[model samples]
Target: MTQVGEGQEAEESAPPVMTFGAPTAGEILAERYELVEHINNDSAGRLVWRGVDVVLRRPVAVVLRYPGGDSATEMLQAAVAASRVIHPNLVGVYDAIDEDDRAYVVREWVDGQSLREQVAAEGPLDPARATAVGNAVASALAAVHATGMVHGNVHPGTAMISDEGRVVLADARTDGADSQENDVRAVGGILYFALTGHWPHHEAPLHGATAGHGRAAIPDAVRDGSGAIAAPRQVRAGVPAYLDDLTMDLLDPEIAPPSSDVLAAELARLDIPADDHFLESAGTLRFTAEPEDDRSPLAAAGGRKVAIGIAGLLAVALVGLLIGISIFGGDDKDPARKPVAQPSPTAPAVEDTTPAAAAVRKLDITDVKIIDPDSRVRDELDDADKVTDGSLDEGWDTQSYNSAKFGNFKKGMGVWIDLGAPHTVKSVQAVVSAGGATAQLFAGQGNFPHTSSGDKQLVKNYQPVGDALEQYDGTTMTFSNGFNADQKYRYLMLWITELPQKEDGSGKYKIGVQEITVQGS
Candidate 1:
């Protein structure tokens, strides 16, 4: 998702300014305000400018557009009306001016980028972030609704989340009278975008199904309203069932997503095991779960299978979502990859493929030791170096996009070793012992010791020779070709699954290997 840092970029033809004509920063506004910088343009030719109200000497976003006819007066009236509402989540309006044959709505200037900007910079948001943000926007909507006003627009562009974790709703009912229904639907749209990293109106299944063609049901009856859209779970697999259930429930025409406070309370009920947070800590402002479909014939027949009233429809969408995920990293172990018969060797790394993903610090490991004398397996985040078995420290850091606790990940987080060639690799082999030792092997393409973020690749597991997995201790297991053994490749990943745990608040050990051995010729 995150690429090397670059300057601000706009989508398609947005031009960074939501204006009819480019107005330079510091330009005097309406003989009173001073334009600081350009923001974005709205559907109408109106542009938002961050400037200081020279008279008030306060920061404000000024919506500037040449005032024309009845439409101009009407937009001004809508602003005048919306600015009356007061709410923490809602952006407050300070003034609305109909001056010099032009209209401008003056409001508090939030010091943050829109969610859209954040997503473009960082592919998708972590789930926890999606929820917290979604809930906050929902609260903003409720506050707007409580004042007998509707936001009218709830797209990602209208929601702003400051770095401090506060949510602010921008843009309100500019239309004289569009049904309040639009505001509600917009909330749904906002939540969808926050979760999926794409707007809801695009008419596509975000990541899984084809655009405009979703696998979930749009029963003829649902076509009349919001009833037909597939459930979030069907669209994104890892999404918790409660989330799916609640999100889908909100889509019901009869059910109003309880008031924002009520909604927050409901979400709190979805605690721990009740939600996916227990499985892992995704984040507070997450949107939806990515599908867990690893398309191996088994993923087709396996994985968690659940279908309800829209059973058949959900099933199809899942198949498509799973199919897409499986193609990449759905976690299927392949036994036969390259044929035993000689095949073509893939090309080299282009020699200048820079490190694509961000990194912790560039470090060359001159030595690696998997602690074994200790007694339990621990998460990499604990000390990443299996310090329990030995001493876990010195490997803690955060890159621009990801955080790494070298020893915090399961021993199987990644495996890196020289494979010696560039041929199409078939299988991989590791002398893994469970005698309280756990290691995870992953297959991908890229330079092992020095690779680019773009080089980091993930695929299903390797196909082994025989089903050779043997468990040794509570924290360890041993195995061979139930996965593949590689011969000629660039890198390998051996993550930690078992290591010495602290017993009586004591004891430590780490399970790893001396070196990786490949099987591909």
Candidate 2:
């Protein structure tokens, strides 16, 4: 995962001028991004460069690959598709552009080294750190796979650790050159690398993965006659047995690979409860002495009593000195100054305190109704209330259609809710129950169950609250300026524009919403 920083150009096998289409430093693209310097060339011959977004005044990484053929077309399409799915662990794509002979993708720039670099400098990492990295990458893959898409490029080069200690998987190259299984196997490679400082994949598609002899410089797993790669514990000491088995299972092709979602959950269970935002704030939690105010102080009278006890001991120790002084010089010396005691120093300072945030309660849905204006599926209309019944076993579902986009058979479908009265809404959370459902939220002061999408009442009163959430199972949306607190509404809608693939593989699709909870006053 080598990144070309400013002024650190990567070695180019082909002439720079020819590979980059003669673009020079300071050159502007699409009248927005300004190229600063060429970073490096990927195994696919894609030229990565450091650039700046003039409009946003932010740093960006631009990947450009030339001789647009099927590869260029696939790159641009994949970039556009990947941009539609957003998750915290995935790199954000800003723009994807295609010219006649070239294509470029502008994306968020990470300010840190790659996993490969991290391992190289720090040697092998502990089991906990390796599991944490695996969990992050798996989580990102789950989000990608949920959209019915594959992140064809999952390698050490794509796993990035930012300066903020955030691990994100970047550069989703869905060129159909790889499969979901390959992504799963790559996680094993990451773990093996973290524990043994080696890469097990000899045929990795990325550059710099192997030495001149066509083999990984450091081999984490050596193949046996049975074609099963040995576990990490065989090669590295101090590796936990559970982690070793998990890594071996992931690497062995004979063993079935778990889905991204399942893998993410398993790794999360094994992860240590340490902060991942060490770069954003203090790296770790620490203890400090308590402040003086934190302890109960005794009354002044109590302090005098303790001092008197100490004074009695001092008087006995000084008795011999007092007698000798009085006999030697009765009137020569003035009376010795009375002994005094000092109070204890103030207590040490206490650690800073941060207040906890208030919890958001779910608002009850007063009434739920099927708002199928076109009467697309009158059969399922009676089951609409099942969505708010607080039971996942039985909930509202759309009629199955041949295509995910409703087979172009009817207009969109949705569930409308009545709050009983106007109330300021804060957020809307939905448990989709199934994958591949694309939905959105809207608010308005409309009459109940309009007949059509172009109904006069809806057109005059309805307004969109949050943007579309594509292919999600559980999603939460906080309304923005369009649905502010001051602009309260009694009616809300959860509209479905697309449905997920059929669970039975029938080439048909349906949508299931187990629950819908609104958080507001």
Query: What lDDT would each prediction earn against the true structure?
Result: 0.46, 0.67
Query: Per-residue lDDT of 458-479 in model 1, one digit per residue for the tens?
Result: 3122212222222234322222
Report the error of model 2 at residue 281, Å: 26
Model 1 residue runs over 4 Å out of place are: 1-27, 174-177, 202-230, 253-261, 264-521
**Residue 147 of candidate 1: its Cα lDDT?**
68
Model 1 backbone overlap count: 84
Most accurate candidate by lDDT: 2
Could you tell me which 10 consecutive residues in candidate 1 have the lowest summed lDDT? 1-10
Top model by TM-score, which number?
2
Count of backbone clashes, every candidate in sequence: 84, 0
What global local distance difference test value does model 2 have? 0.67
TM-score of 1: 0.42
